[model samples]
Target: MKTIKIIFVITFALAGLTLSCESISNPDPINAIDSTQTATIQGTAYANMDETNDTTFSTKENYERAPQGTNVKVVLNSRDFASNIEPGVDYKSLTYETTVNSSGDYSIEVPALGDPIDAEIYFDSFKTSQTQVDSTEEQRNYSPQQFPYTVRISAGLSTFNDAIYNSN
Candidate 1:
């Protein structure tokens, strides 16, 4: 019986030691494709050419003067310029991140790897609700019209300088 008790104590001690020695990892690393090169596109918002409204002004004025206003967004997808891009060959993956700048310029970042990055940008417009206006009185004055915008970026070369060099 004493021998059995000794063995039991030894087993319990070994189990405790093993449990205490276990290692744990904290702060998991973010897993995302590194975009070594970045491409940036900038533009100003304006009323659509077909629209008869002359409420074209800075987002500040538009938001303050009209009941409806528009917001800009940058969009990126797995597409190739001129030709269809194969999912795995021309483009590996896709991720969408959006940012609203204090200067009213909407920015988005996407991951793409290929010769030309094919993408589009859409402008979203909406009419402010009465409740919204009461809450954000300053931004509720714009007209109620929205237009869509599209942007296409060349791949590999991320900057205007690179584009110029390639053309030459």
Candidate 2:
């Protein structure tokens, strides 16, 4: 009976020790903010002219028509509150805007707030000069495109490459 009691006590002690070690390793409370934490969203914005509506294109044409120096905006809206507050309250939201370089590459850094930050990316319209089949240059306008899905970001870099916008 004594031996059994000793074994039970040892098992209980081991369990307690494991729980304590786990708590020690993770001392941060839920949703604890680390001021230095940030996340980067980067991608290339492509402006393709799909006149045929077949959704097929040549690689050379796509590279030549890529949008350059266009604005890209990343927004993170606050989650809905338990009360009557609406989703995406202004006070808790964040917006980061940047312009793509000549290579159609853009990067935006946002604070890593919640456990998983949800953001939406928007591409602004731009005007460029395009050569017509007759060898004449004319100005062409491209419409803005918004990401259809919400992007989830963590503490590191999140890349959303190949953001192609079809300008028909």
Candidate 3:
């Protein structure tokens, strides 16, 4: 049995590209069709690490950029042609990793879904804070967001715009 769900996509790919179409019954056109050109994906991540002025939510001003060296995980699976896929590559393979710049932002790219008929994306926004001031004691209090990060890939879709973060 397939349970229906509605997802409001607040992000769009560059150049106003709509790789898939939407319908009243199904919010995602990618799942309905088998072959297409590409897919759109994006989102924001928030974590409480170094909040200046002890603010509750993370903000760019308060938090230092994501230390440019940090890398985020992105996985994709175009479940179509067996030959196209490597000997053992599928979704959750961690085949792709991208770095987050000082702005705590990342652009995720995966094989387009339409090549076969379907593509799924999983982005991991998990990172630990580093100690500042060479502290012997803990740098700061920690409280992580339980829910997965919100996505902002499609121009037509948006949710939780961007994450708030504070610098240590």
* Global lDDT of each candidate: 0.42, 0.64, 0.41
* TM-score head-to-head 1 vs 3, winner: 3
Give the best candidate by TM-score.
2
TM-scores for the candidates: 0.37, 0.58, 0.40
Candidate 3: where is the Cα deviation over 4 Å? Answer: 1-36, 56-64, 78-94, 114-168
lDDT tens digits, residue span 53-117, model 2 = 33346543543435666777777764321124444534465567888887878877776744666
Q: Write the per-residue lDDT of candidate 1 for residues 90-129, one digit (tens) a residue.
A: 4432445443344444444455455556555554443333
What would you estimate as the lDDT of candidate 1?
A: 0.42
RMSD of model 1, in Å? 12.5
TM-score winner between candidates 1 and 2? 2
Q: After superposing candidate 1, which stretches have Cα over 4 Å from the reference?
A: 1-34, 47-71, 79-95, 128-148, 155-168
